[model samples]
Target: MPASPSAKIRANVPIPLSEKAIATRFVSFSGLNDDKEHIAIIYGSPEQQEAPLIRIHSECLTGDVFGSQRCDCGEQLHEAQRIMSAEGGVLLYLRQEGRGIGLYNKLDAYALQDTGVDTYTANEMLGFAHDQRDFTPAIDMLKALGLKRIRLLSNNPHKADDLVKAGIEVTERVQTGVYVNQYNAEYLKAKVDQQDHSITLKQN
Candidate 1:
């Protein structure tokens, strides 16, 4: 008998969180590319009859890892963990860094943004799409976990829209909002004005 979870879940280990005091399970996928070996971390039970709360988080090394305030990635990540713990949810951490343009190029886009250019336009300036991320892998993970429907916790409507088009049902969209700071004021505004993310931040 396998000591760990089945092959689909490469390994299932308990993540003991001191602050929230919740039981967390980190489930690794079976067949993903080396560069995109994403993981699904769960809190509470995702197999409920009601749509489980979920967040499909793309890789944001700067924010998530280093706590960069340029974007709300880090804030959203923490909020997801907290909300999921209470609501019983799943958070899929996809490895599509820099909106699928990889990390180094993302820094180039960042430099362009420094020149007063918008986020999407900066990507176009560097010969990349505005938002090149694909949520299919996230959908694949959800299907593998037997979750056909979910209450998505995100501010990006595009995520929900695309997921529905791809056969997954997005029952409700719970906005993930965070405090705004001077460093990220413009960044947050652009997300609403340009990227169509559902949030209203005071423009400075």
Candidate 2:
């Protein structure tokens, strides 16, 4: 539909993660408009598979690095790694912190959320859109990897839709495990209610 993205691979190095057994390579790209350091974690041999599993994970600083249970990001990331490690897939770790609102804004939103508001409402109150992430760069990264078809690993339908719109055929959509705790229950509910994420969670 649109012009093909002209992104190119900058570097790809095989780096063993802390979980030594999960073999992966960190792939860097150049020529994105935002110029952020977004990377792709390749596990096994995706190019050799007919439809490799792929996850377009936005960067979550607090939840991902710090193991914050306020959200399910950290758990989901590790789950992706486990799946990709065994089944062979790709992980496009986008530099879209806090749904593209940036870290500081997200922290501010967190303050609002602590006051019993939904995640989306907090952003709206701050004069920002519910989800400000741009998946265009992800598409470009996929193109650079020469992936025409994939099996998407995500609960959000938007990820699959965006990939299809950008000429990447999503052959299947695999839902990630729902890691719901007391803290993140409402947060998960907001996502399911607001964005129609495909997650079935019983009330705790």
Candidate 3:
């Protein structure tokens, strides 16, 4: 984990999500790379808890906002919200679209995927790494929230490894729900096979 610049709370506002019927605290941060507005959707009073549940979710415009079935990002985001809303947690929504390769490049990679290449291979064909997401911003966000330790809600082991390297103690690793659809079955399998994401898929 590389050292990132320290972040501070830029703004905090209470916004009620109509679909989930959950009142969340929308927090934005300052002093990050790219000057993009990453958000921290706070479900409960994590500052009051010993080890709050945390999910460092990367942005997925197609999947998260438009509900694209090509990936499980949207499902995972909602699942995190459902659990955190009840159990008290912080969802750090990092603006790392397309695993940090940017949106247009991601679409180009998608075109390559349509030609029978896996996601990682498509990225490689475009001269990008398999996963370019930098977790330093996530560390900065966590530190800004005054969280020294947390129960990480994710299936990605890299997240835990990065946090630990940055001196943030991950108390527990909780797996998110495995959302397998016909459109994303290959994508999900690639995650488990290539990246070692902790997921169990149905054997057909």
Best by lDDT: 2
Candidate 1: the clashing residue pairs are: none
User: What digit string (tens of lDDT, one per residue) describes model 2 on residues 1-204?
Assistant: 233366899999999875755578999998876788999999989999999999999999998899998899999999998888888899999999999999999999999999989999999999999999988888998999999899999999998999898889999999999899999999999999999999899954
Quote the positional error of residue 12 for candidate 3 in Å.
1.4
Ranking by TM-score: 2, 3, 1
Runs of candidate 2 with Cα error greater than 4 angstroms are: 1-4, 18-22
Model 2 lDDT, full chain set: 0.91
Q: How would you encode candidate 3's per-residue C-alpha lDDT over 65-182 as one tens digit per residue?
A: 9999999999999999888877779999999999999999999999999999999999999999999999888888889889989999999999999899899999999999899998
RMSDs, each prediction? Answer: 4.8, 1.7, 1.6
Minimal lDDT window, size 10, model 1: 1-10
As a TM-score, model 1 comes out at: 0.89
Q: What is the lDDT of candidate 1?
A: 0.82
Which portions of model 1 show Cα errors greater than 4 Å?
Answer: 1-7, 33-35
